[model samples]
Target: MSNDILRLNIPPEEPNLDPNTVCKTYPELSQEQYSLCFEHPDVTASAIQGIQVAIHECQHQLKEYRWNCSSLEKKNKNPHASPLLERGYKETAFAYAISAAGVTHQVAKACSLGKLKSCGCDMSLHGKIRQKWEWGGCSHNVEFGEDFSKKFLDSKERKARDIHGRINIHNNRAGRLAVIKNVNRQCKCHGMSGSCELRTCWKATPEFREVGKRLRRKYEKARKVDILNKATARYRRIRKQTRRTELVYYERSPNYCDPNPLVDSPGTSGRLCNKTSDGVDNCETLCCGRGYNTLRVRRTERCDCKFHWCCYVVCQTCHYNEWVTVCK
Candidate 1:
């Protein structure tokens, strides 16, 4: 594989990957897995979309948090260097969840887009099959997506029996489950004389943002698990006691406010913060007892609008000053 292939393996990279030659792009993946990625042309597209969706959704989900998921770029570039991987932090859970969800969302969409030759829109609905209603819309083929994601993403942890390995597998599956659970039926009513006699419904996939939101909720409620004899049944029992939908971790996250290059902490210095709110964006709490600086910012906007003539309207430009806060 070439540098392009290596660069395209993870998210935040340009999504200009060629669909036909994706498998050859990732030399890190096992030969068997590499071949599997190209087993069908649709897999290529889905795989690319998966990486993009994971990073984009994760960044959006953590936009307000102190760390803001920016550590993902480094983690993706060097998986072993990631602090999240070494410790079961909330950030680690988010990473696993977003990556799995991305693959799940893309595979389902690719199936509906006619990219997958083996499966099209879902036709297993009882109403459509029984002729109670017409299947006039494309359904998200979540079944295929879930299966494919399991086979592909889980393969990464196949040889590992460590606690981190097990946690990764669990989190990844949780992400996939979030996507499958969010699939809903979207229907349209149709009948002669506008009567409510028949309907056509299709399984629709939720926006990737919804999946991210669900995972974020899981991250908040993530459980700390103990690795007791990871090779024995006791470990399985302990892990099984936790809810499968909840993200499982082994350690608490570090205080990300301080600069710690060893763990990829960028620190909150110079970070923009909101002075008007008490949320995560609040300057005081985000700066971790470190003082902040307030600056007067000038801004312009279209302030006044007036109707003109028959079809047009115009607005007047206005200037305003606002106070902005930043971590010092």
Candidate 2:
């Protein structure tokens, strides 16, 4: 399990780039990376990319949920009562998952795209055991990604022994593992006369949507785990049984229907809900028994496209009426 081939060649900072400014401008960069800012100056771009991608993926995944993962965008002016800091909530699980996935995907992508000076296309698998396909293409370096993500994101929990800390670390690892597990392998066939003889293959990380989908599934089946004393062997047994891909929690989540300014929950008031469906997004459930307001609106769209002449196409504009339901 040696990761000797996954090292990063972080270079000294450019004369014009200030490490302090980078940290101040992008608050999402982990403290671990900030500490090593002088050595790895180029991490600024990667950090920003990771945070943006993570937030986007989280919102996309939770679009149908009551909370909709909106807490991730909060400035956390008062960090003491941050909504996303909850330990046992499904939102917290998603936050950790996407954060890890973002960092892993971005780092590997940056390496492949030559955007970062620290690394390049994964060479770790280039000279390994013989296989049917040759590893000649630019493969996403999941090993380097996982190693760097753990070092940066899990550094805060290195000496943490509490249950919450362990839970956070576990969820973070789950996020990174999800990305690595879902890597899609693509191959190019090479032979004479279209006959299959040899293949050039490479591994690529799936879209963040895939990562979010897997994490959401994990959220649905999340387990309530017991936090036992380190002195007891039961603790070891439970830790061993917890799978890396599973989301773990210790307590029930708070009802997000009530507006809790303390936790930054804005409640579901005025939030749009589906009027016809019987799912969680249905107005009956999403409105939280507060009743819903139905409104009719004119929707305008272009339809009946027809190609005219050689270069242009014409479409007709149509107006239709539809109803939108919102929580009262």
Candidate 3:
């Protein structure tokens, strides 16, 4: 596709904002806007490369949000889904974002150099398309079905086995400490220097040393058995929980940009509602909106003197209450 066919107005310079940062900041663009921006070279080539990068980043954020929302919905329905699936979703999303970012960078680079070819139709950002395919392939392979569950279970089993081995080591250390204490006590009773006798006695008297070695081995074996038993019990409990607990994988929904209150009321309080009422009077006073309280009154005289009974609704975000009345 020729970049000229779209006849995009090329800006002299790209915006100063970082595309990655902007995408990370606002995670609520719709899928259509995201696709349109990236797929149509004209959309990005028209603006300075930096502006194009920003728009591309916005598209990535949008895709991420939608993926999250979808994943969440799936998890809600099936609580025992495979965790691998969730991991796959995250990996895939990240891969997609990175690929998209790369493509945006490349396109920006091309446009900046004035080497961009005008395409007759919307040209696929080549780098991003390749990334999408790679990530999508990974996502597909991470299948959350029976095979995935088996692998997940196998991993847990291996971890449990490792824990058992560690428990055995701890038990062995405890047993060794006990034997060393006993040996020291015996040496003290024999009037032998602790370290000197412990080192020499074992070497000089092969029979005595062999007996001690056998005893130590027995103690270690018993301790290991006990540790294994305890570990087995713990593992059983963990396995039971793992088998019963559902692993849900839900895609997070993209957050929609909060509609500008001035342009279109979000059917609720404005962003100003988030402001602290430190200087405002009656900051603690409740507002009519959801969870939104008015600033605390600075003085009794400052309190509204109107004598109408009003309903108080809490602002979902701020938990402040404001007064509202339905016209009779």
Query: What are the C-alpha RMSDs, in order, of all predicted structures?
Result: 8.5, 9.4, 32.1
Q: What's the distance in Å from true for residue 281, model 1? A: 2.4
| Candidate models: Cα lDDT each | 0.69, 0.67, 0.26
lDDT of 1 at 87: 60
TM-score of 2: 0.78
> What clash pairs does model 1 have?
none
Task: Give the poorly placed runs of model 2, Cα more than 4 Å off.
Answer: 1-21, 28-31, 74-81, 127-132, 191-197, 227-237, 297-322
Q: What is the TM-score of each candidate against the true structure?
A: 0.78, 0.78, 0.15
Shift of residue 52 alpha carbon in model 3, Å: 17
How far residue 241's Cα lies from its native spot in candidate 3, in Å, is: 29
Write one digit per residue (lDDT tens) for candidate 2, span 133-236: 67778887777777777776777655455666677788888999899888987878889985758788888989877888888888888888765542232434
54-90 per-residue lDDT for model 3 (tens digits): 2233333322121212221121121113232222122
**lDDT value, residue 304 of candidate 3:** 18
TM-score: the better of candidates 1 and 3:
1
Q: Candidate order by TM-score, highest to lowest?
A: 2, 1, 3
List of clashing residue pairs for candidate 2: none
